[model samples]
Target: MQNYIFEIQLKVRDYECDIQGIVNNAVYQNYLEHARHEYLHSKNISFKQLTADGIVLMVSRIEMDFKRSLTSGDTFAVKLRIERQGAKLIFFEDIFNVSDGALYLKAKVDVIAKINDKLSRGEIFDTLNL
Candidate 1:
């Protein structure tokens, strides 16, 4: 298990599943994204304010490993930790089944900060103490 700084629990919805009766590949991205946004909110950072300040957080890369399938009505938690890696913020995120503690997915997301449409060194993140 990784050292996680934040976690958010979510339940799988029926519509999120495909004909295979498991969550579609694309739906997992939404779960990860929502957890990130919630983490920012917990730190008192507003995405709207960031945009007003000309600071844009963009996804440079994302790697997801599907270890197990999430079926409808399944409960899970998205756990994540962030670290500074030069000009980017690397998020190590994982999903696990809440009921059985089974690992469902592992993801690494690379986020780059842009100020005034130019790539930044992510100093803003440091000041935020995130």
Candidate 2:
């Protein structure tokens, strides 16, 4: 079975859909980002607090594949796993239809942490050991 460190359930909203009756591609990015934030919160990490401490985590790159379309009212789950590679933290995220388990999208996000104004490995990630 595929392992996921965290998962969040969400429903497609009417406003998120395009004229084609499917979720707009950009909306999927929001869903993925929300899931990542929630996952960090679950681990007792606060994005706001990090920023306040001068530790900023920014997405350096994102690669996504759209497998299926999600329509308004469709419930789905956003799942993710994290790994550390060199100085970058990679988040592997996937979205699936909650009812049928159909994959809607898969994405890989590379994140880098900056301290003060320099790009360095934030100490916070060391605590997570991801």
lDDT for each of the candidates?
A: 0.95, 0.91
1-130: candidate 1 lDDT, tens digit per residue: 5789999999999999999999999999999999999999999999889999999998999999999999999999999999899988999999999999999999999999999999898897897789
Scored against the true structure, residue 109 in model 2 reaches a CA lDDT of: 98
- TM-scores for the candidates: 0.97, 0.95
Q: Tens-digit lDDT track for model 2 on 10-123? A: 999999999999999999999999999999899888899989998899999999999999999999999998888888898999999999999999999999998897998645
Model 1 residue 110 CA deviation in Å? 0.2
The Cα error of candidate 2 at residue 56, in Å, is 0.3
Which regions of candidate 1 fall more than 4 Å away from where they truly are? none
Q: Please give the lDDT score at residue 116 for candidate 2.
A: 90
Candidate 2 TM-score versus the reference: 0.95
Please name the candidate that would achieve the greatest lDDT relative to the true structure: 1
